[model samples]
Target: MTATASRHRLTTAKAMVDGIAAEMERDESVIVLGEDVGAYGGIFSSSTGLLDRFGATRVIDTPISETAFIGLGIGAAVEGLRPIVELMFVDFFGVCMDQIYNHMAKISYESGGNVKVPMVLTTAVGGGYSDGAQHSQCLWGTFAHLPGMKVVVPSNPYDAKGLMISAIRDDSPVVYMFHKGVLGLPWMAKNPRSVDEVPDEPFTVPIGKARVARAGSDVTVVTVSLSVHHALDVADRLATEGVDVEVLDLRSLVPLDREAILTSVAKTGRLVVVDEDYLSYGLSGEVVATVTDVDPGLLRAKVARVAVPDVPIPYAHALEYAVLPRPERIEAAIRAVVGA
Candidate 1:
C-alpha cells in the first residue's frame, strides 16, 4: 500500500478505505467481510477500490446474512485474525446484535483473557437526507452503553483515518460509527470538514481521547460525529459576536474521556452537550452526569443539551431536521448555557 500524499485532502470515505487498506497490507490476517463491500465498494464507498487492491479473498463479499457474516468475523478474530466487517447501517444492528453484544463483546472476558476479538464493526449512522426511521439512526449511545465494545465516531477525514487504523490494531471488538452526512458522498449533503488534508503515513489517533475542534473560554460544547461539524459552525458564528465557544469532538465513546470533559467544563464553567442520538438515557445525559458528578459547584450556568428527542427519526425533511441537533438548535443551546 502506498502512502497518501503529504497534506493531501481526502474525503472521509477515501481516508477510511486508505486506512483499512494500509492495515490489511501490513497484516495479512486483516480481512474485510460485509454486504456490497466488494463490487459495490460499499454503499457509501468506504471500501472503494479495496477489492481491486486486495482481491476478493481478503475483501470477501458475504451474502445478505448479517448474523452469519458477523458471527464468522467474531470466530475469525478469536482464532487470531483481524477482520474489518461492515454492517452497512448502524440502524440494522437488530439483525445481528446478539452476535455483537453477547459473543463479540464478551468473548474475551468470558474466556478469561485467553482469547481476543480484534475486529472492527464499521457501520453508517445519522439521518439527514430523509432516509426514513428504519434506514437512519445514530445509535452510538446504544453501543456505548454496552459493556465490552469500543465505540468510536470520527467527524473528519484525519480522525477517520487515524481511528480506523487504531480500531484495526486494537485487540477488542470496536464499533466504528460513520455518519453518512460526513462521508463526503456525492449524493449526500456536504460538510466542509468531511473533506480535509489527511497525512500520508499510516497514523493512529489515540482512541478514547477527545479533540478540541476550536478552543474558547466562553462556553464548551461537547459533541461527536456529524454534530461536531454543527458545533464548529456554531462556534465560528458565535466568535464573531464576541461569544467564544469551545468545541470538543469526542472521537470515541466507550472509553468516555471524562478528564477532557471535566477540563473543558471547568475552564468555561458552562457546558452544552450536543448528541445526534436520542436525548433520554444517551450520551447527552452521561455528559451532564460526568460534569455534575464530581462537583456541581463547577457550573457557572445551567447545562444545556441539544439532541434528538425521544422519537424515531422522521422521514420528512422538516420533521427530521426538527428532531436532529442541527447548527441552529446547537447555537441556541450554547447561548443558553453561556447566557450570551
Candidate 2:
C-alpha cells in the first residue's frame, strides 16, 4: 500500500499473495479461506506469509470439502464480505458445480443485479510436469463458457498481482486460474516469465484487456496463461529465422478480447493459436471463430493450431510433453504458417 522507488519482484504465486495482503490491509471486509492456505501457505505458495501478517481469523484454512467452503464464501459475499476462496486445483471443480455455476455465478443475474457476489474463486490450472489428467487441466473454456463469472488467467507475476486486486475489487464473482508452471514453483519446470517486478502500491489490470506480449507482422499467435510464455519464446526463436510471430496474451477469458485477436490476425494475415487447453471447443476455437466469423479473407494462408489433442494428460514426462503445447510446437506452427 506504500509507494517506494525500490523495485520489489516476486514469483507469480507470491505476487498474487502480495496483492491479496495489500487489499486485506486496505479493507477489513476482505478475507481469504482455502485448504492449507493458513499455516501451510498455498500448495503453490500463493498465500505465503499471509498467516503471519493477518493471523488465523482472517486467513483461515478450511477442510478439504471444496463445495462446502465455496458455498460458505458465497454466503459471506452476499453478507457484504469480500472472500477469496481457493479451489486448489481446477480439476476439482466438478465437486462444486452447483455452487459455482448455479449459485456463485448466477446470483447477480438471478437477483436482477441487486445482489452482488464479490467473491474470488482462485485455482491452479494447466498441465506440463506429469501431474496427470485429474490434477492437470486448463479448463479455461469450461469456466468462460458459463455466464455470470469473470474468468481471468494470468501468465506472469505482474499480471498475477494486478488481476488479483482487480478480482477482489470486482462486484461480481471472478474465477482466477493460475498455471503451475507459471507460478514459479521450485519443483515445477522453470518459466522465465513467471517472476517479474510488481509494484509496491496497489494497482489493477483491466479485466478484459489483451496484452500483445510480442509484436510481429507475419503471424499471430493468440493464447492465455503459460502458453503466452511459450508463444513469446516461439516468437523470439522464429524472429531469428525471419518469421515475425506476434504473441497475444488473453489475460482474461470470460470477456474474450475478440477485437485484439482480430486486430492481430488482420495485421499478420496468418494466425496460429497455441493453447494448453484442449484443441476442440476451447479458447483456441473461439479465437479462430472470432477471425473467421468477421472475415476469413484476412488470412493469407491456412492457419495451424498448436494445442493439446482431445486426450487425457499422461503421467509420463515423454507422454505429457507430447500433448502439451510447447515452444517447439508453437515454433513449428508459426514456421509452417509462414511457409518458412
Candidate 3:
C-alpha cells in the first residue's frame, strides 16, 4: 500500500516499532535485545508491542546490564543474526563504550571485511523532559566520530519508519538516535509534527541524505532530531515577518550529507546550525567546516551556531530549557545570520 493511501497518522515511536516488526516478519533472524524491550516495550516506547508481536525469543528482555546485552548483540550479528539493541538512553553509553565503539563499530574492518556486524543500536536522546544529566543527552556526535557505524536520526514519523527499516537492513552497524520529545508521548511536551502521517508499508530512507523540511532563500537552519522541529517552528514564525528561512534536517549523520548542506548554503549564502549536541566538536562545527572547506567565498555572513554549552546538562527544568536550542534561540540565530 502507498503511504498516501494510509490515511491514519502514527507517532515517531510507533512508526519505529512498526518498521522493526515488518522486518522481523520477513526475517526470523532479526531479534531485539535490551532492558524492558520485551514487556515494558522500551523505556521511551520505541519497542512497544514488539514482545507480544514477535514473542519472547525475538523480543527478549535482559537484566540491567548494558555491557552484556550490547556485547551479545555484536556477537550475534557476527553469527549472521540481525539484532536490534536498545541502549535506553544515549547518555548511558558510558557503561558499554568498548562494546559499541571497539566491537560493534569496528569488527568488520578488523576482520578484513570477512565479518559484517549487521546490527542497529537504537537509543533515546534530548533533554526537554528534565531527564537530568545522566538520562538526557544527544551524543550522536560521538558515534558519528567513530568509523564503521552509520548514524540515523529521524525528525518525523515517516522518516523514522523508513530509516529504521534501512538500519535493520544495512550490513554495517547503525546507531538509531530518537529524541524523547519527538516520541509523541502525552506526558511530555512535543511538536504537532511528531504525530504526522506515516506509510503503512515498510520503506527505506537512504543513509546520509538530508531533507529540506522547509525551503527559503534568506537563511538556512541546518539541524536534526528535535532541533529540526524547533527550527521549523522558528521558520514558520519568521515567514510571517517576511524573513524567509530554510530548515534542513540531517536525518543521517555518519555519512554526513555534505552535498545537501553545501547546496542549501550555496543558495542562501548564510548558515545557522542548531543542534542539541554540545557546541564544540559536534554537528554544528562539522556543518560550518563543510561549507568553509568547499568555498569560504560562498558564505556571505558569518556562521552562527545555537547549541548546548560545553557543560553537563543540568537537572532543573529552567536550566535545561535555558541550554537547549529552543524556537526563540533558533529564531535569534537565524536573524543574526540573515541580518533581519
lDDT of each residue in 56-136, candidate 2, tens digit only: 999999999999999999999999999999999999999998999999999999999999999999999988878889999
Error of 1 at 149 (Å): 0.2
For model 2, what is the alpha-carbon lDDT of residue 57? 91
RMSD in order of candidates: 2.0, 1.6, 1.2
Candidate 2 stretches with Cα past 4 Å from truth are 1-4
Over 111-198, each residue of candidate 3 has an lDDT whose tens digit, in order, gives 9999999999999998987778888889889889999899999999989999999999999999999999998987788899999888
lDDT agreement with native, every candidate: 0.93, 0.91, 0.92
Looking at model 2, which ten-residue stretch has the lowest summed lDDT? 1-10
Q: Give the TM-score of candidate 2.
A: 0.97
Q: Candidate 3: which pairs clash?
A: none
Alpha-carbon shift of residue 62 in model 1 (angstroms): 0.9
TM-score against truth, every candidate: 0.98, 0.97, 0.98
